[model samples]
Target: MIDTKKIRKFFPAIKAGRIITNNAASTQVPVQLLELLKKLVVQYDNVHRGQSHSSILTTEEFESSYDTIAQFIGAPSRKNIILYRNATEAINAVMYSLMTEFKDGDNIVTTFMEHNSNYVPWYGLCKEILPKFGINVEYKIVKFDTETGALDLDHLKSLVDQRTKIVCCSGASNFLGTINPLKEIKAIADSSGYLQPNGDKRSYLLIDGSQLVPNTYVDVGELDIDFLVWSFHKMLAPFGVGALYAKEELLLKMRPFLYGGDMIAEGMVSPEKVAYNSLPWKFTAGTPNILGTILSSQAIRLLMDFSLNPGKQKYFMTDKKLERKDVKKAMDNIEVHEKILIGEALKILGDISSLNIYGPKTAANRTALVAFTCKNKSPFEIAEKLSNLGIESRAGCHCATLAHRYYELNPPASCRLSFYIYNDIEDVRKACLAVKKCI
Candidate 1:
């Protein structure tokens, strides 16, 4: 078991007696990261646009931040990582960058289990924007088993044909709390011999890892995914930073999502010809979030240190390069801890007769969240009552509208209790007991 007492001390929210069980949306920032933020302010300056010593220092930190993030996900290098506002924006960036690649006969395949951020952008691409231009692209959604919350692999396989351009899926369902079989999905995508602009003959796979990456180890290289997106805020950093990881070749061939300012190569822009900057920077336009970038990277470092040696500061506020084994060990520990917490939550909440839980019944098959609804109580009312009892919970589709609707929930919402590294068994008990009281 993880040292919850030691872990709780790092987060002021836990100390303040707030039972923070809504971690799927965003995690509370640790005091270490807060302190790092303060340190960054004194040395703050815009990166790649100044000559001051502070600018140079901040620039190095910001750039190295990419390396830290890339290494955490087992990406090849910083070239594969692009920062965005959130996972939603990161996925949209992929849509925008690859917008021109769609053809008249092409289609995209997603699923009913996706968060709206993953589904709506494709919906707009195929149904709205592409149709307006007279491009006859289609978007197909695969279904999951209503009872099991498992993806219909056969249905997913049937949706991909030679004309399928891209396959979008969530790494884990935020609402259903199911961990998808990505390698199986990747195999299905690979079998679809869809030709691409880059001469590739398979559908590109994009995993919306907003939920997966924060709770488990996600090696982009090992998974062999063409693209992956997630947010730092979900992993204990403050808001305003997210990440997109794509293959180096894809980033090289795709169009830049945004254009202006520093994305252009130094002294390479003119009326006659314009050139873009190298690799990751081409995707980052204008003034980037330098301070947030630094803090987010340090957040990963701090998480590693916290997992490996709780309450100690080995990796945070240091310049050490993260080792691959350490990343695996830290993430594995986190995954196990979360499994235990979620298992206990499922048990406690399952005991309530009127409460209908969504997603995989086994914690081994799901992420660290439990989303459910009580038959006689509206989800919003239950969530409000839980709040009154000083317990935190989320009520809504939790942005997984498609999944919520798939379950045929009236008003289409659920009450969710999610746990993180700092959350202990006691917190889960209180949240579950409060849920019982609310019902």
Candidate 2:
């Protein structure tokens, strides 16, 4: 069995008696991940344009992170991975790229269950200027039954049609904790690895992997996703860093969302002779977040292989030593343990007549996130009450406004308690106790 205690030991945030159940909002940073950020802040001063040894070394470290994360996700290579400020920017990059062909009549199929980060952008893109570009974008949301969050793949098939251009979805929902049926959805779209005169690439299946990346080893090749994005901040990395993965040829086609220096190969003051930078850099203008990227790299490396502790430094990069199967097995083992904890929590919470949960009825189709509602208590009030009891939980809509509306939870929202690989039975017990106190 994977040693969860050893993993939990690395996250000092658990020291306070608060059970941090809001992992869907933000995860507890492990000590190893924190140290890498500290090293970047404490020692490194250069970002992007530094020419000194520290700058060069740190740059190498930052660029190396792109490769490490790319390899972890099984991307074609690091070149396809471009650094952005966060998942929002990453999403914007994809939307901005689509500015060219999208017209008023064309529809984009997305879901209601998306975090605002995913939902709002498409909404804005569809509403704001799509008509000017001739695209009348319509949202075909996928909501689940109150009994379970088994995503409506059948409903999705009905929405996707000849006019549909893009299908954006979350790799995993942040609130309901439901894994989407993307591959199945792709099959409905008739989107297979199609023949590209330039290269092999199918239509788009962009996954917002923000909530799913740190917990899962997602092989991009296996999924055949046309695009994917996630936040480094969520993945035990520093803030201000995220990734946008696109087929290089597709990246070559999209327009830059923002314009500034470093994005242009050479541009003129006048429009007479403006030259945009080639693939990748064409989208990323100005100086990049080098330090954050470096920190993110180190953090990802540590999570991928925890043995690479900073000072001790001998335990990491089993990239060669340990096969991907071993890592998946360890993660799988931990997932099984988490499922047990979730079951215990459900059984305990179900006994309380006032309490209710949203998502899959069992752990079979669910994730670590447990979203619930207590009668006569605002979800936020429940969360605050739990906080006072030293139980850290999430309240409000959990950024899943669509789910809030779909579940008929109304303005009060639902409480979310998510666990990572590190959590044990005791944490579940504490959460149960805290809920009792809150009630």
Candidate 2 lDDT tens digits, 296-381: 76666666454223233443423343345654654565456667777877777777888887777777666677888887888888
* TM-scores, one per candidate: 0.99, 0.89
Q: Which stretches of candidate 1 lie over 4 Å from their true place?
A: none
For all candidates, the clash counts are 0, 8
Return the number of clashes found in candidate 1.
0
Clash pairs detected, candidate 1:
none
Cα-based lDDT for every prediction? 0.93, 0.71
In model 2, how large is the Cα lDDT of residue 339? 72
Give the worst 10-residue stretch by lDDT in candidate 1.
Answer: 1-10
Misplaced by over 4 Å in model 2 are: 41-50, 132-134, 191-203, 266-271, 307-323
Compared to the true structure, candidate 2 yields what TM-score? 0.89
